[model samples]
Target: MQGVPYLRLLGLVVALTVVTSVIMLIPDWNGEQASTAAPKIDQLLDVAIILSSFVFSVVMVMLGYSIHRWRARPGDESDGAPLHGNTRLEIAWTAIPTAIVLILAAYSWIVLDDMEATASNAMPVEVTGQQYAWSFEYPDENIQADELHVVKDRQVAVEMRALDVLHSFWVPEWRVKRDAVPGAPGSGIDDDFVVTPDRAGTFTLVCTELCGLGHATMRAPVVVHETQAEFDRWAAEQEPIPPEQPQPAAASSA
Candidate 1:
């Protein structure tokens, strides 16, 4: 009888873990993994899901069993047995969770360190965010455009700043996000991050921050060229727009 309950609990846990893992992995939750760091991010998510499923299953099964096994009888109003805490069980639970947390923390630190490592020969692109639009500037080519274009399989270092208010640059496929804060005293001018796109495709770059009335429409197209020559060709075809010249102070009214 003693082993029967343990066997049932073990069966329940295995069943729950399998069902939960399938549900978690079946959905296209994180979307396409286009950047070099995206695969690592997705792996971390899977680890979290597996751990969470086991923890949830254990808690739920124990709680359900306790409620059913200790339920009061239909017409008997009597106090239940006064149970003292089990020191061994308490210590086991505490130690197990602490160990799990430490392991998770260490794994996460490794992933973060690798993701933030600087890449050599990264292409620089300046990004400006405003009330309702995003603009990109290629400093090397001296061209500004509404869309961002980069070479596939190359690292891109983005320097982003907000012209008016706060905004966030997020590309779902790239699995990276950074904030663009206004250039004020003590406030950072441009926040930067590097992303190496592994696939050549069109992605959407949207402002994840709520800045103003037109926040919902603050989005731009991101094009990842399959080859460096293709990107160079596109850049060569683009001409820099000249800055508008102001009239000579209305012919000096005074």
Candidate 2:
């Protein structure tokens, strides 16, 4: 009899968690999984969602049950019985939350490790972000292009840098974003977004950070080539960008 309420609450929480998690997982929450890093990252996010759903269910069920069961009755003024907190339940909640946090941290580390894993035959592309545009430079080919071109099934090790103000390199399909820090020569600007694009298609490279008025238009094309030959053919036809351009729109995304 003492455990009847606890059992009922547990059942309600479980039911709510299941329903919430299924509803949350039904949609393509993160868009198409276009990069090699997408699956693992998405999996990690799903785990978090499910965990959050369970936590939310617990809180909601407990709050509702307490409100209904322990409500003050509409009667004459009377004193309520004095009670102390349940030490066991308190310890349980603290320990459970700490354990949950540790589990999430461990899983996050694994996904991050996979995202940062080094790969052979990685392509290097310099990602430059300014107030209003993005420019991609192929250091090896010495070709500067407005479009960020990479070979499919290959790792694109992007070296990110900002010119005018702080910017961020974000492609939603890539499932990972990194900040482009502005720096002068020898200023130790070290940041990169390592992405292995599996799909061969064009995606938009957007600046997630708010830089300036033109920030909304600060977008470029991310073209993934199906083969090395195709990428080379396209690269061969592009002209190197001039040393400087006053109008950023002319050089890159307008």
Candidate 3:
């Protein structure tokens, strides 16, 4: 009787959850995890998916069940019975969702904090983005290249800036993206971001933002070397950025 409806609702919710989770949450939805931060980001995504699936399942099941079980009978057109809100149920629903939101907020902060906490020995790479290309500069080594090359299992602090329009630096496997804002040399609208690449492979650095005419073609290669020796070897072969020539004695300062 009453218990039967509850049991059926529970079964429906379970089945719906399984099906939805399989469709939306599983099957490599977040793509490859190649950085230390990637796993944490992926875990957060999984939690979000699970919560949303359950909420959607409960709502849809209840809506359908109520429509079917309480439809008006034939020739019985009349005002529906007045129903008062259940204080306990309302409070429970409000409190539960509030708790879920708080939990998610806390988890999201933790992930960002962990990722933003740069290591003491992290390598620095200045990344510049133009309308249709990206460049990587290793200041310490005085190396410059169109493609990014870094050592695997090492943290890279990306000093990012845009020459013209806004650009975004995104490495799919890293699961993090940061915007590069256009600014003057020392105007300092900072857009610095960091990532620790754990995987040694060739990835692509793509601009997620719609910057302008050649936006679709704005992509560069990223190479993560397996060892310091490999990275050093590559670095030794690249052309160094030419040192800026000193301006002619500043026109005899007043």
Candidate of highest lDDT? 3
How would you encode candidate 3's per-residue C-alpha lDDT over 1-254 as one tens digit per residue? 23447888989999998888778875798788899999899989988998888889989998999898889999997998787867976897899889989999999999999999989888999898888999888998998999999999999999887777899999999998999877723566758878999999999999999999999999999999999899999999999887972334532233
Alpha-carbon RMSD, candidate 2: 4.4
Local distance difference test values of all predictions, in order: 0.85, 0.87, 0.88
* Backbone clashes counted, model 2: 0
- TM-score against truth, every candidate: 0.86, 0.90, 0.86
**Over the stretch 112-201, how does candidate 1's per-residue lDDT look in tens digits?**
889888878788898989899998888878887899999999899889867778999999999999998877223544388899999998
Model 1: residues with Cα > 4 Å off, grouped in runs: 1-4, 184-190, 239-254
Evaluation by TM-score, superior candidate among 2 and 3: 2
- Against the true structure, candidate 3 reaches a TM-score of 0.86
Task: Compose the digit string of candidate 2's lDDT tens values, residues 141-224.
Answer: 878888899999999988987877899888899898988887622466558758899999999999999998888999999898
* Ordered list by TM-score, greatest first: 2, 3, 1
